[model samples]
Target: MPALPRPATGPGSRYTARAATTRTRPTPARAKPDIVALARRLTARDLWLTALIHEHRVLTAQQITRLAFTSTRSAQRRLRTLHHYGVLDSFRPLTVSGSAPEHYTLGPAGAQLLAAQAARDMTDTLWRPTSTGRIAYSPWLGHDTGVNELLTHLAAHTRHHPHTRLPLWLSENSCARRWGDIIRPDAYAHWTETTPHGERLLPFFLEYDTGSQTLARVEAKLPGYAAFTTATGTAPALLIHTRTASRELALRRRLTDPARDLGLRLATASLDQTTDTPHARWWMPLEPTAGRLTLTGLAVRWHPLTPATGLEATDADTPLTLPVPPLPPAPHTAP
Candidate 1:
């Protein structure tokens, strides 16, 4: 028999595990879309959506609506338009349930336009024609969508509420780039809540769990976070969002010993437990029973934690030469 080829391996193998196992959908042979025309037709919001899709790898129609649009129907209408224009591509995963929401990724013309706006060559953008297909077929698609869902809810809250802001939201890739040595959180964020006295800031590392990994594997992540705190002299409260209430209980039980030993500020919330929004009193501390607390309440509870330094643009050790602003651009107003 002929020898089989070795699988691709590198520093990024952990992130690309699904790539080797899953086959990308074949692209149909068709004429390339008019990139220049699409670029000219792109609006501020359209460009922002393209950039966001590029950054996060994938977003569901519902998530995009929560992040930008005013209504589900309108968002769907606009998304259809964009998808038809070859500016966005989408896939609906087959679920045991009736149907799944459409998930969106940057299309070919969108990638070219985005790269052009950034004054970079197509090769530098790291986007390929098959990128969307890879995302669609990956097992991690649901987990990624869940991560975006939580953050988008928080970001969208600012629209209706006054004096609340999501100042910073770093994706898994961004978090890894910044703090990969000691610990790489699924997401790192800053939420500012207004108090009568002044403003209170909540900096947290999010671990969105789908209950796929073993409890041991989940509990094993604590020491790295502790080491990070010790090394940086800054502690960000860790919030684990679980799929079910039972899973949250299991994790809390599994993690309590080490989390206490390491003196890590940890909390867990489950999807079933949160009735209103993520901002509601859903998060429960890993410690003894009291009651659920809001995200801001967790901030107040973990007062000892400090905002991470070197994250600002003026800081010397900042990761990106120019950090991406957390919020998208405001709608252009007619003067």
Candidate 2:
């Protein structure tokens, strides 16, 4: 007669008394938060975060925390706020172990904000970020981020250690402006490490290698470095960071080739050496006679790098500044 309707066996159907189950509830991701509402809530601190992302071009979540925030938890909340309001954009690379770190780049709203701060037309400059920001996804992102990792490590170390300071941290682009024709070190920095004896300035040209280039290609850059040192009369140490132990060994051999007879002092180390506690990292001098040198001890290991000029010579190529110890933190008062 009227056949009974088929039993609904699907999970949502009323086929059984049982209900679907999950171990735990997961937080849902925000696809796109209310842009206008979030825009109205932007704070001065948020603007500073945008400026930082703009200046660095690319920074990991951890790096951002180091740059601005006191804790990762707070950094996450703030980054989410900026991302929702379109002032910051982020991407994570695929990884084998654990989750990937979210790397941030300045977004359209950040560009507009910067333009407005400078009293410039947003139409032209605001759109510039799209052209500039896509670099976070470029193939070289790994290498670029690796280079920046070294910088962030040094900056963080400087913050904690009283005896050390990173006074001048210049990006590769800034180095290009300063020494473009001669040689552009991936970066240029003045490291001042104090001891009971005295503070020493360890200024060096950083060459962060990702092991993508052949040893031959690496050697090709040596002559430029040698020439730059000779011209400046300030022997800025040429510091090379390789991706692996084998890569470091290969690079060290290239640095030792007497046939090249490079006048510059070369130091080689693997990425593992500098990832954490950068101050503890060792840079093995190309000279077999010299042992691996710690970050603070570079002055003793590479004495030649220090300008020979007398203290009266203010015209020194790169003037070293006195160490500035971190100021004591303010006392917390009861709320």
> Could you say which candidate leads in lDDT?
1
Candidate 2 lDDT tens digits, 114-157? 66665566663334535443563355666666677777777777
Top TM-score prediction, candidate number:
1
Which residue segments of model 2 deviate by more than 4 Å?
1-48, 96-98, 119-129, 258-260, 304-335
lDDT of each: 0.74, 0.61
Judge candidate 2 at residue 122 and give its lDDT. 60
Candidate 2 whole-model C-alpha lDDT, 0 to 1: 0.61
- Per-residue lDDT of 40 in model 1: 61
Candidate 1 TM-score, true structure as reference: 0.85
